[model samples]
Target chain A: MPETIAAVSPAGLAPEAEVYTRAFARVAVERTDHEPSRIGTLRKAAIDRFGELGFPNRKLEEWRSTDVRAIATTTFSFEPSAELVSEADCARFRYDNTHELVFVNGAFRSDLSRLQELPDGVIISSLEQGWREHPELIEPHLGRHAKFDNHAFVALNTALHENGVFVFFPRNAVVETPIHILHLGRGGDSPVASFPRNLFVAEENSQGRIIEQFATAGDTDTGGNHFTCPVTEVVLAQNAVVDHYKLQRESTDAFHMATFQIYLGRSSNFSSHSISWGGGLVRNDVNAVLGGEGCEATLNGLYMVGGTQLVDNHMRVDHVAPHCDSHELFKGVLEGHARAVFNGRIFVHKGAQKTDAKQTNRNLLLSPTALVHSNPQLEIFADDVRCTHGSTVGRLDELGIFYLRSRGIGEEAARSLLTYAFCADIVQRIKDKSVRRDLEEFLFRRLPQGDVVRQAV
Target chain B: MSLLEIKNLHVGVKDAKILKGVDLTVNRGEVHAIMGPNGSGKSTLALVLAGRDTYEITEGEILYKGEDLLEVAPEERAREGLFLAFQYPVEIPGVSNVYFLKAALNAIRKHRGQEELDAMDFLTYVREKMALVKMDETLLNRPVNEGFSGGEKKRNEIFHMAVLDPVLAVLDETDSGLDIDALKIVADGVNSLRSEERAFIIITHYQRLLNYIVPDVVHVLLDGKIVRTGGKELALELEEKGYSWLEGEVHEEAVAHA
Candidate 1:
């Protein structure tokens, strides 16, 4: 266990910390009868840890470039339910023929969820219900994969999370259709905050795909300021394969942070796609651990930020066993006064020989005011490791633009075509045709000059 | 009127002059070959005619279809049916060949007040042009010229010209890196595209390409000026004697004029 700072009183903490302390106190008193339960005990330990460490500051090396001081000092009250969200607002993100699980304000809404004709050996339910019905499967993997001792937001989420999605794929079960979990944040009359927690477990020889998306309601005038902290834990057994995609489309005034912890067993394959397009201040922490030999992991991310938004993606792939391979590519397009940061780390342990790792981070700034900080690092304790990392920050390719224009494409349309081409490789990597098409349309709609290219082409 | 005309055109790059005084005229239904040693401004003239912004037109005028061509933008020039097969074709990594050609075709068609072709019609048209250059069908789905071999890139340029069907096609050393087979294919494609309404300006250092696509007229360029103009026999003469004979003639002429 990592050492924790001394716990301080509510008055001595920051405003946001005080709010969390008060919220945890109320929840702790309400569940006094269930104090002896395992979840209750975990919650108490997590709240205690949160009180000890408060919120991470820029003093820590990991938090040096990404300062959460503004988020930590803002006072936001916990809202168990939001009243303004409608079914229409959620319909825009729905796909065809998939199991849909919806959560509003961090609370499960069975009326808004659709789960029909699931295959055998598959369980899809809310976390609270999963714990009640399938404790044997949920208890062993819930908080075990995601360690909260060193992460303040994870600890905070573990303590205050009300309900989120729970997925379990038993041995040898292959899910053909994807499972979509939509977490909608709707602000009420006052500033609100919610902690969403997810647990995913795939047994041996199982294959599955999961899409976890977060968004806000359409009306901005009624939606007050809010903060969202989510934590997801994934455990893959031997020979299991899973593809997980997370799309964050929060409101412009919202502060969102999420931590995803993934563990891969022997010969398991896991791929993660993290696409972020909204939120005023957003941070994503994705860490994968290859616990067995011959495990393969691929991480890809694309962030499009404009206005005053700030987005950060911090990823780590740990190779603990030999013959494990990991590939990561994270790209960003920043405009206006927006800023972005990508820090990718790969670690090969002492016995993790024959480890092959490649990491790349590229950023395209559309404006002079936009900025990006990309750092790709590798730490190899083994001798026979093939590791490579690179990063680039620049504008659109001028020659490519000229080449397009010389073909009779307008100047603005040429710029848009080149920018879309820059992002085409990452989009082409998605296996699902429908999802890839939808994402392509969504990204193209956000471009400043995509309209012209769309009309001409 | 001549289809294209250049009257005492003087162009420069920054401070140095590239083309001192170049005068040329090409009528419809004719093929003109410009033969010169390296750095004789053959490629520069092609770039300037295609409206590349790198070179400044210090003095003189260029007339395309009896209009002031210098006042037009690069894309406008392209829309006006001026095509330049680049000396070094650019490799665009993510724009597919089919999509790029379709976009360019539609833009030019719209400028010419013609209806745009649908996907089916466009593919049909493109497939026909692709066959003319003997190009593989798989190359159409790939990004523009990306990962193509030297010969493939040159073939792709001629393939594009075949699809666009430009009125004035400028071939700038199209045979530089091509093998004999590829050079034959390119020449055949250019030959098939020739018509009474179209013309070509084939710029080359080697006279070997002229053997395949015989030129109606050949101009020998020296020191940014057309030193001599003759019939197709001049290309065969230059091929046998090399550029040294022409260089000696130009030196003698300059000495006698002085």
Candidate 2:
């Protein structure tokens, strides 16, 4: 494979110098290979903005609690993977009921994917194809969900993404089966970087679910530097419904940052769930804008981290229209010396009367060294809204643990069961059964022993 | 030989004595009922026996199957054939009842050098046990004790006991919220598990349960200690006269002895 990450470098960005240097080189090579077009201009603008800002430091507002100094120093490279993932690797990330769209190292891997029957009026294809055939569809929604100037990672993702899946469900057409997207990043012995972008549009009265997963291609514990910056946008028309799930399980040396923007039309229902189990420095920026009247939005997340890994989930539910309701729940289980950040905010606009918004963030630190920073904020401009927000950080209830152990469950098993149960509330919200099962299994097998020291102790 | 023996066992929680100088013994094939009003330490003894860490064993020894029970952790005590049916079984929202029961059973079986049961075998075994308790099949598939009615939760507890096949089962107020019909079903489930090598300490507040699952020995606990011991008929007596009468009698006896 032609090395792109080594060709380009960024000079003198003190805090994010290392990550910028690595990302700049990788972005240069990947962008060079892409067919330039009108959409490419917008993506390029995002990249330039990112280059100017670099990765956010502690000085940034949204990144205060989540510092990515480690990401800045990591020696990683990007470009596409040279190795081919065998059929066995494909089987490792399969979902039973849904059609799989596999992207290896940010490029769509056709050999590893199975695209099945689609209902009429439903458009499903790679982002590269969408750019050429349906340029109008990708123009308005791309980079529209995230703020380019404020988010360095968001800008970086827009600038360098080579290929991703694009899904469009036309008016009144409901796709019962979920659309599954698997993004596998294999760093191997050297640095690897990928920018995976996904855009989903549900027209009026349309309903669907999108399940996206990111992980390393094969099972090796090599701590090579890697970064996956992903951007996903969900646009719902009047009375539309969209359920989205993002699963991030990368190598420990990998840096993952994703922005999920959801737009709800009049009377629409949108739900977004994210489970973070891997990544060295992971940050997820999720925003749901209830644009139409009587729209409903639900944001749920569960993050399980161990080792020295840092996982952060930031959520904002903007209640723009009256008679809208939005609920956000985020829970975390931190073991070892792992640290997690949960910041959930609910914003009720002035004219958005009768808005009902609720937000809750709960953290269970199993080890004393396990650190969790939970911040729940509510900004209400209207007086006639019922808005409540709560943030709690504590260890698992001793009484609950004792109750489980008294019933014959071993201590370790009891702890595991309780932690799973704590996160299961959010996992069950996933409408897709196979996706939920896959997540449950991943959380069980890989979550046990990873961190250096127990954080909750 | 006694299946469970607690001699001069004293336990407390957060420096407050809950089980003070309590002495009890239950032989195999016998049912012992510990009846007391709320705050009388009947539940504390059960928790202490189950090796719950909340109740610190300040001074005393608990011998179960001739082993120092207090020295064992809660899970170890469970592996040693000990089970506690919680008065309010925790509602684990994501863990199905069958999964939790199978895990408990497997842990006990592995402790006893028995092979683990795979999915098919566990389903069959648990289905049969669930039928014994007349529990709804839906409850077994749902998360452990979650969304269960009062009686359903109690019956699920007994079903777990039936699966674990513990040598000593401690039912902490298992009959507290059950109707007569549900109580009969739970009593029958416990009766079927009774064997020559197993014993039960059924904790309850009312004598109505003792009517269905007749106890060989009845112990009256008050103020963190077993103040009086009697036959099964004593439950009927206490039910009629009320525990206040027993407290008066114990106080009189203590004064006279002093």
Candidate 3:
């Protein structure tokens, strides 16, 4: 390969780029004696791309609202491989009898994972392990769905990605239990950054459910301003069905930027639910493309922010084949000085006739200072397509509050009930009973007057 | 002692004086019907009694159970055994009927030093009271008054009155948008809740509802003040002769006083 490194100028790359460069050099030297691998080549190409692109600026249309200058300025070191996490740390998020893969600071922890009693043809393991054991099954679809050419964050993640969760469901296999992936970020004295890359593939005629959870360790002081940039790629083959969920509850001072790219085959069905509750600055980019005819996709998200938090959700659904349908619903509740942004776009190609797409974004501002910006767009070129989009930003209904209060419910309880009710529609869309119940409980406890509402209910 | 006493209550909404120096008193076991034309401040009286802040009580004194009612908040008033059946019931989309009623009952019970009922006990109590308005069981699980028809919403108000079982109930235009059958069912529900320790103030524009739930006294409210007070037969007389007769009588009284 030709030399791709340019001279470092005074204002060229960010302060954190030096750390990534040093880490990449160490990894390359360590793997020098090993056999030539496709992942190595991909990593080298990604590092070159990252060096050229750097971090996205505010002038970019996609990064207009979200500013990552703080992240670029802060020096974050890559966490070296270590056994820093314990089983007790993972106890709270574990579910019974379901397969789980745990990652601490972006490194897979096999000691804390439970993969017994998995169904036949179901592969649930760490990404590094999967690449070593079943490279044939992992190589063809690993980085194909999530293209990092244009996205600077995706490029940076691909360049620094080490170990994360990998799940595969073979053809004709149906998994009854959901696979859980826990990404736990831990920080010490210095700020740490983790690039977690996850790949999920459901072969033809298969069915599966994946729950990806991102959280920090206990206590706010422990995680000292860490950064988590995760990228997930999903592929659903012909006649396959998959339900994907991403629950992000990082530390209050953390920065979270995630990208989810999905591809749907012929007659395939895919749905993703992203619930963001914590983090100082969070932005999620979710895109789904219908590659074959008769495919269906559903994207739903809910974000609750308070106390100087900023959360943004940007989604795009592309109808590339005829007879494909996609639906999107995103709701947000913001309080204090928190702000939120929602941008949803639906595109129908010229040849993709009979496409049906609907998008809706609704936000509730709980305080006078809380604000939200919503933009819903539809770009349709097909003459025989039905596409509709809407956006709304409002406060809690005062009359509704008075109605509840007149019935002897306290003002605090009434307000909390209304807030919960505002997000209930999105919570009800989750198909798993346990997941829905857990999310409801989480929402109830997260609201301002949650205790009062919980007791009243 | 009277259950409620409004002495020269002067109320206004924004710039308009809706109720000008209205006086009324209601003792336990008495149903007082205040009939008036449109924009005559009948609904305003009910809302003011319910402690709604929309109306400005410029000069008034309202005593409920020997305590000042204006000093109380709306939720506190509800917990103090005072209920107001709204003319237009609000449709709260996410709160279920059962949950709202249970919360109201528990809040009131807690205020009265009574033990709160569990889910099972609450269901049993609610099932028995729901029959007062002949409400369907399916409606209990649905959101509070959401997508309910006008008649169904009126029936739900009455259902809430029956369930809450307040010491004093203010039914504001409860018979406005109801068919004959719904009117009868609602009137029956109201009658079933009447007791020697309970009082009711029914504000309406029509005398037809008084035929079903006979009131002890009939008061004609013209503009703001009460112009006439008579026995239950006064409603029939007002029905036979229209409200124009009362207006003429009020004008004659004013001329005679001048």
The numbered model that scores best in lDDT is 1
Q: Write one digit per residue (lDDT tens) for candidate 3, span A384-440.
A: 998989999999887777777777877888888888888878877888766676687
For candidate 2, write residues A383-425 as lDDT tens digits. 8999988988887767667777776666766777777778878
The model with the greater lDDT, 2 or 3, is: 3
- Could you report the Cα RMSD, in angstroms, for every candidate shown? 2.7, 5.4, 3.1
Model 2 misses residue B105 by how many Å?
2.7
Error of 1 at A451 (Å): 5.0
lDDT for model 2, on a 0 to 1 scale? Answer: 0.80
- Model 1 per-residue lDDT tens digits across residues A1-457: 2323422445656556777878988864463342237777788898877877878876667777777877877777676665556688788877677899988888787887899788897999998788777888887887788888888899898888877878999999999889999888877666667888899999999999999888887753335457889999999999999998888888878889899999999999999888888788899999999999999999998888899889999998999999999999998988899999898999999999999999999999999999898888899999999999999999987666666676787777887887777777888888765567667887668865675455433
In Å, candidate 3's interface RMSD is 1.9
* Residue A83 miss distance in model 3 (angstroms): 2.3
TM-score-based ranking, best first? Answer: 3, 1, 2
Chain A: TM-score in each candidate?
A: 0.94, 0.89, 0.94
Worst 10 residues of 1 chain A by lDDT: A1-10
Off by over 4 Å in 1: A1-12, A28-36, A219-224, A448-457, B248-258
Question: B54-167 in candidate 2: lDDT tens per residue?
Answer: 667888898998888878989888888888999888887787777777777777788889998988998888888888899888887898888888988899889888888888
